[model samples]
Target: MRRVPESAEAARTLVRTALAAWGQRDLIEDAALVITALVSNAVHHARLESIRVIVTRPSEKCVRLGVVDRSRNIPYLRTDSDGDNTRGRGLLLVDALTDRWGTDRYRWGKQVWGELTCD
Candidate 1:
């Protein structure tokens, strides 16, 4: 996945593989959703040649997903003008689906991340 919109799918695949290996198959759906949103934001906004996707088991029951890109711009949940609007809802979905979400800033870029817990 090379900093393109298609990379989101690749990221999702990685998430699925990692989760299933960790016996967290139930998280595949929500994890995929978050990786897509985070990757899509990077591809559309970062304009870099490469990006990084991370799926980590911070704890036995928690998975943290992160997308790293070389852009100073941080992602925020955009306020929708109306309910009918079809765009800019990605972070909104991330917030609803994840137990917690935030970013890690580095000198080169930022990693926007979300966490999901087995319930």
Candidate 2:
């Protein structure tokens, strides 16, 4: 399923709903945090006109969540160049928390996706 929301709260809510529906309540907090960071990055850095959230279940024990933004710019993993900088740590958190995550580029935009194992 794909949902487009204009605000961060809305995006979080969408993620929460998906988590609930998947019977993965335990993952909601981290999932929501990741969604918020990705969506916020889409809105802020990509200047995306809209964002699409997609939740898919490929197996009984795994759920894949993707945040698609209308930007061709790809996201990268970066080490903090300055210790005092307050940003650029979101993807780092995602990497640490999720079982698997990656980015896919499409013709119109790109999808940043993460997989959560419910088992």
TM-score of each: 0.92, 0.86
In candidate 1, the residue pairs with backbone N, CA or C atoms under 3 Å apart (3 or more residues apart, or in different chains) clash, namely none
lDDT per residue for candidate 1 within 1-119, as digits (tens), equals 59988888889899999998988888899999999988888888886799999999889779999998899888898875768877678899899999999989999889999999974
Q: What is the lDDT of residue 110 in candidate 2?
A: 88
For each candidate in turn, give its C-alpha RMSD to the true structure in angstroms: 1.4, 2.9
TM-score of candidate 1 to 2 decimals: 0.92
Predicted structure with the largest lDDT when compared to the true one: 1
**Model 1 whole-model lDDT (C-alpha atoms):** 0.89
CA-lDDT, candidates in order: 0.89, 0.77
Per-residue CA lDDT of model 2 for 1-119, tens digit only, reads 22333566787787889889878899898888877777766766665456777777889888777788778888877786768885787788778777889999999888998887885
Which residue runs of candidate 1 sit more than 4 Å off their true CA positions?
82-85
**Highest TM-score against the true fold, candidate:** 1
Model 1's C-alpha root-mean-square deviation from the true structure amounts to: 1.4
